[model samples]
Target: MLIDWFTVAAQALNFLILVWLLKRFLYKPILNALDAREKRIAAELADADAKKAEARQERDEFQRKNEEIDQQRAALLTKSEEDATVERQRLLNEARKESDDLRTKWQEALRSEHQSLSEELTRRTREEVFAIARKTLADLATTNLEEQMTDAFIRRLHKLDSAERGELESAFKAASTPAIVRSTFDLPSAQRSAIEGVVKDVLAIETHVQFETAPDLVSGIELSANGHKVAWSIGNYLASLQKHVDDLLNVPPKAATKAIAPPEQQANG
Candidate 1:
């Protein structure tokens, strides 16, 4: 209003200087402190998140290890059961084999004992029968029986077949020792002369004959030249009877009765 230009220019210069001082000292310092606090809080949050992730990974690894241990335990149990079953089967087989072997041995032992008993029984029976027959024949022997036996021996020589005659003749001719005539009893002079005459006539050769008394002949007469022999005896008949008895004893009881006569009846006949 008064036309004072100098006073107005000085006041405007003072206001500009005040605004620059406020911005440089007060506003700039406060803004820098707030930015530093925000940076520190962000760094703490990132560290907490990294720690939580590591803990989760460790938990997962522990669970996997527990599952693997469970599988290993199950496999071990199955293997043990299989092994037990195999062992049990092996034991059963061994027991069965032993039982069969024992049974077989028992049967064989029974068969062997039965065979031994049968053989012993047969032998005893044979000895007793032979003893009885020998005693009976010996008691029945007589001088008349001896004479009859001598006559029978002579008849047998006369009835010889061609083969027997030739064998006897050859033996007599080739003999280095004299022909022997044996009897259970001594021959009477008449009987001896008859025998000598008959032998010479039948053979048509001059032959030396020796006589022998043999108690074992059992009412028998025998003539032997070299290895050839002609004989007649009650003992021969008894031996044939014994053979038949032996055959009967070997057969079963039912069959034996139908097969042959009893030993006593055979002896009497």
Candidate 2:
């Protein structure tokens, strides 16, 4: 424990020199190395942070793009569905119109055929009736029928009204050709003379008369002067009967009555 100041001072000086040498050589170089390492690590850390931010931005962009793609897909699907519906409706309308047109055409065809059949039936019936009437009349006594017809014709002339008498008188006076008297059979000389005498008396004129046989007269007698004619025929009666039949069959009227010429050529009287 004895105090020694000189030894203590010397040992203190050696300790200070050793400390300065270590600070200048070892500690300063080690500190500089540590600082360089820390700077490198900080730079690496900053780079990693920047990379992470870029990755986040890319992810966000990708997510937004995915959402936009989904919306576009949905819109396309909806449009496709609407278009399909419109097309289907158009096709259905076309089909319906075609069906209606076809049905109408078929109905028209059927109606036309029905009318044609009705007309044919009416024609056949008329021909058969005419044939039957001709046969029946032919089978009757020819001489008696002729005599009766002549008497009837003479009676008709006598029974003529004022208008009928006047028309015949005028026609006889104006006619350049002889009056024609037609019948289904030839008139006997006596009947012919009687008819001529009556015609002259009724017309009150001297008129030449010509006689002609017309088989189509069908048990009838006709007197024609100029364009005027008067007749009584079974054909007229048959024509009236045919009119009734045509009405019953719902047939349209035709120029089927040939028993008399037009009013300009014949008088009903």
Candidate 3:
């Protein structure tokens, strides 16, 4: 229990020295290592945060790009569909036009064939009628009819106007060949002499005369002087009748009506 100041001071000094040693060598070094580790960990954490932000930005950009691509694909698909629809319509229209054209051609062909058949039938009928009439007239022909026709021709010649008589006289004067009188049948001697006298008296010209038979005349008489001819024939009346019959049947008209020369007009002459 005795108070030892020397010992106390010495112990205090020793304790202080130990504390300084621990602080300088152990505490300071440990504190420096911990501070360095903490500084490195803080730098690492900051780097990780920056990387995470960059990754998030990249993810957002990728999503936006994906959305844009999807929209583009949809637009392309829509455009393709529209184009296909238009093409389909165009093809249908072309097909319809072709069908109409074919139908029109078919109808035209049918009409043409029908018209040709009608015309052929009409032609055959006309020919048969002409044949029958010719045969009938030939069967009905008589000597009395011939006499009457010869007399009628003589009267017709005498009835010629001044101008016609002058033309006949001039033709006879200029003609180098003899005049010919053609009939369906031979005229009697008396009828021939009567015709010769009438021709000479009416025309006031002297020309040689010849009589000839022409069955094609078909109940007709024809007189030819030079290139001029005068004729009267039942064939003209038959032609008129045939034309009227064709009209009644509603046949197509000919290019022209056949002309039958009048008594006062130039005929085959």
Candidate 4:
């Protein structure tokens, strides 16, 4: 090592200058670039973390919306099922009511038809019985029957009470035309004379007489003065007999026996 103080001093100064230049131009610029790159990388990492959090929130929200839609669909299905059940019950009730109505109408129609048929049968039976009775009586009629009827008429006129006699008298007096004496058959002169005499005696009115034959009387005498009438007929007896017979046939056994007993007793008496 040489001991040269002036030369050493100059070399040391040169080495110091070189070290300052290297620090200012090379080391300082490299350090600043590295620091700027690290700051940029940190900012990018923070932005990536924020975007990841937002994506997770959107995924959670979509899941929740799907669950809500499922609940709404279930509720709608339940409501539709309930409506269908109610509608089915309403239709069943309406059908049952209509069935009942139809059944009632059918029963009523049946009853009406039965009643009509029964009434028609009863009417025809009554008419036939009446015709038979008329024919039988006409066949049995005779001169003796006529005589008896005439005599009965005369007796009835004689037996008239005061009120009936007065009514006949008033009718005869009010008549502008002759009083009519009608019978089913013509009468003999003697019977007519007798009837005229009895009318004059009982009623005490001198009235003209008109004797006429009316076959519709069946076996009867009918006298008409003004609007008043006096009549006696075998048809009345026949009608009473027919009614009694009808009652006996139509009634129950016990009732028929009791009804028949009365007529038999009356006839015997």
lDDT of 1 by residue, 209-252 (tens): 88999865644678899989888766666566656866766789
Candidate 4 local distance difference test against the native: 0.79
Indicate which candidate wins on lDDT: 2
User: Model 3 TM-score?
Assistant: 0.43
**Model 1 misplaced regions, further than 4 Å:** 1-143, 254-269
The total number of steric clashes, by the backbone 3 Å criterion, in model 3 comes to 1
Give Cα distance to truth, residue 3, candidate 1, Å: 81
Estimate, for each residue in 1-269, the C-alpha lDDT of model 3 and write its tens digit. 68799989999999999999999999999999999999999999998999999999999999999999999999999999999999999999999999999999999999899678756655555455546655665678623556667877887787788887788788878889899999877888888898889888888778778999986564578788877866766656656765686666664344232333454554544
- Predicted candidate 2 versus true structure: per-residue lDDT over 1-269, tens digit per residue: 67688889998999999999999999999999999999999999999999999999999999999999999999999999999999999999999999999989999999899778756654565456645655655676433556667888888889999999899889888999999999877889988999999888887889889999986565579999988987766667666766786665554344335333488545653
Tens digit of per-residue lDDT, candidate 4, span 1-269: 67788888988998898889999999899999988888888888888888888888989998999999999999999999999999999999999999988889998999898668755554454445445655665667623555666888988788888898889889999999999999877988888888888788878888878899986564579889899988876667656765775666579987666666877686885
Highest TM-score against the true fold, candidate: 2
Clashing pairs in 2: none
lDDT of 3 at 105: 94
Ranking, lDDT, top scorer first: 2, 4, 3, 1
Give the Å error, residue 80, model 1. 30
Q: Which sections of candidate 4 miss by over 4 Å? A: 1-143, 252-269
Give the better candidate number (1 or 3) by TM-score: 3
Clash statistics: count for each candidate: 0, 0, 1, 0
User: Distance (Å) between predicted and true CA of 119, model 4?
Assistant: 17
| Better structure of 2 and 4 per lDDT | 2
